[model samples]
Target chain A: MELASSNYIETIGFIAAFLTTAAFLPQVFKTWKTKDVSGLSFSMLLMFFVGVFLWLVYGYYKESPSMIMANTITLGSAFLLIYFKITYRKK
Target chain B: MELASSNYIETIGFIAAFLTTAAFLPQVFKTWKTKDVSGLSFSMLLMFFVGVFLWLVYGYYKESPSMIMANTITLGSAFLLIYFKITYRKK
Candidate 1:
């Protein structure tokens, strides 16, 4: 019973991780394709990046595979958005 | 010794929760103020909202206070962003 419950929790974690991590892709793609960053907030992206990085660290300490994996991908996506925000900025 | 170590982990979790949850404020503020949905992606917001909501459920199952608190705040912010995206859409 305990094993089955634990498995259920892991499944939830996996799905949650997948959804949250994959969620950033569309923004990254839209930003990349449109190169329109007028609506993107620089401070939000910077703070999000830092926060995700810290989540990665926390996941490591907690030995949570899902958190580590999700945050790693999220960190990369956030970083790319930041880059695009800067690179595509209209001068 | 173990208690000290556990406290350290809790501290990290708290800070991580705070940063990740609070990080959404700037974007919310910017979008509300500028009414610019040009750079925002609808799919991303939708996906993120669902994902964050799932994370909240997972946190509930896991009984993690930090995760619950963080996701609750983030979910609200994500929802606001989505509302702004729809409300501010250029017709």
Candidate 2:
């Protein structure tokens, strides 16, 4: 790809990264507020958390800013969900 | 980064991508079987679907097989979630 086109694609990737990763915030907030995680699948959260961590490592290796930033934020959200899954389940 | 190191990182990225994307399967299966979407957020699904679509485009541009494969699977899962959210909610 041409340099200019490559830059454009990177821009698109960044936007996509932001949207997908940030999409987790509402779930975290809702669970935090309602303390309701009855609907969440624990296996999914656990698996996703591990996946995000590896993605962070991959981001560092690849030196992609969007991947790094997105995965960091996503890791936070995934962690919150896991926490909610553990804590809210007891209640 | 050295080419060998970059290749290793991409391998890691593919593994992460597979785990994260495949993580959605359980939710989709559960929802399909039980049709329970009460815990799912519509906005999140919508946002994520769009994000995944863009990621697909990004994958094509960047020539990342992992991104393409992962986003394609993720997009399907996201779409199913959205469909379940719509169809199962009425009952």
Candidate 3:
């Protein structure tokens, strides 16, 4: 009973983190198709990327399976955002 | 040595998670002030909010402090996004 309850909790966290991290997909796809990051804020993307890197480090240190798993996806997504920022950034 | 290594790893993950999770603050602040989620995608936010809830549940079940902490912040930020979405959604 206890183990099942514990597993449920972990599963829920994974699902939540996974969904949000994956949420960037549409934006990334849009940006890729449109090649327009004019609507996207460079500062925010920059900060987000940095933050993901920190999370990756944190996850590594903490040895958290879910955190690492979620952040890995986040880092990849954020990287795409960075690419879009650089590719489409306005002068 | 092993303990220190483990500790360092966890700390890095925490820092990373903390920074990235907080990265949404500026956007949240901006959206709150400007009431603009026009550029933000609705489906994405919906997915994100749902995901965070799952993560919260996961964290609760697993009893992981850092995951819980990070997800809590994420949930709040995502909530703000939801509010902005409803407030500024197009007619």
Candidate 4:
């Protein structure tokens, strides 16, 4: 019973991780397509990048596969946001 | 030793949680201040809301205080973003 319960919880974690991580993609895509980032904040991307990096480190230290995977994706998205902010800045 | 190690890991998680969750604030503040969201994707915010809500549920099921706190804060930020997007739409 305990094992089954743990598995269930893990499944929930994975689902949550996938959802949250994937959520950043549409913004990334829209930014690429529109080439507009006036609505996006640079400070937020920088802070988010650092935060995701910490989460990645936390995942590794804790040996959580889901956390690691989710954070990797999130980190990538955060980086892209930063890149977009820098490249798409209005002159 | 094992208990101490677990506590250390939890500390990391909390730190990661705090950073990741709080990272959204700058965007929220910027949006409110600028009243501009043309660069902010509506699809992303919609997806993010669902994801954060799921994370909150997962946190509750796992009894993770950090996750719960982080997701709750994130949810608020995500909601704010959504609200900003709706309110600041260009006519």
Q: What is the interface RMSD of candidate 2, in Å?
A: 2.1
Q: Rank by TM-score, descending?
A: 2, 1, 3, 4
Docking class of 4: medium
Candidate 1 CAPRI level:
medium
**Candidate 2: where are CA atoms >4 Å away?**
A1-4
How would you encode candidate 1's per-residue C-alpha lDDT over B11-52 as one tens digit per residue? 777788988777778878878998987777788788889989
RMSD of 1: 3.0
For all candidates in order, the CA lDDT equals 0.82, 0.83, 0.73, 0.78
Task: Go through the candidates in order and give each one's DockQ.
Answer: 0.54, 0.67, 0.61, 0.53
Colliding pairs, model 2: none
> What TM-scores do the predictions have?
0.82, 0.88, 0.79, 0.79
Ranking by DockQ: 2, 3, 1, 4
Residue range B1-91, candidate 2, lDDT tens digits = 3644657767887999988987878878988999878777888888889988998887777666777888899898899899889999965
Name the lDDT of candidate 4.
0.78
Candidate 4 error regions (>4 Å) = A1-4, A34-43, A84-91, B1-4
lDDT of 3 by residue, A2-80 (tens): 6455456556656766787788788888889988887677777777888777766665554456767887888898888
Report the interface RMSD that candidate 4 achieves against the true structure, in angstroms. Answer: 2.9
Which candidate leads the pack in DockQ? 2
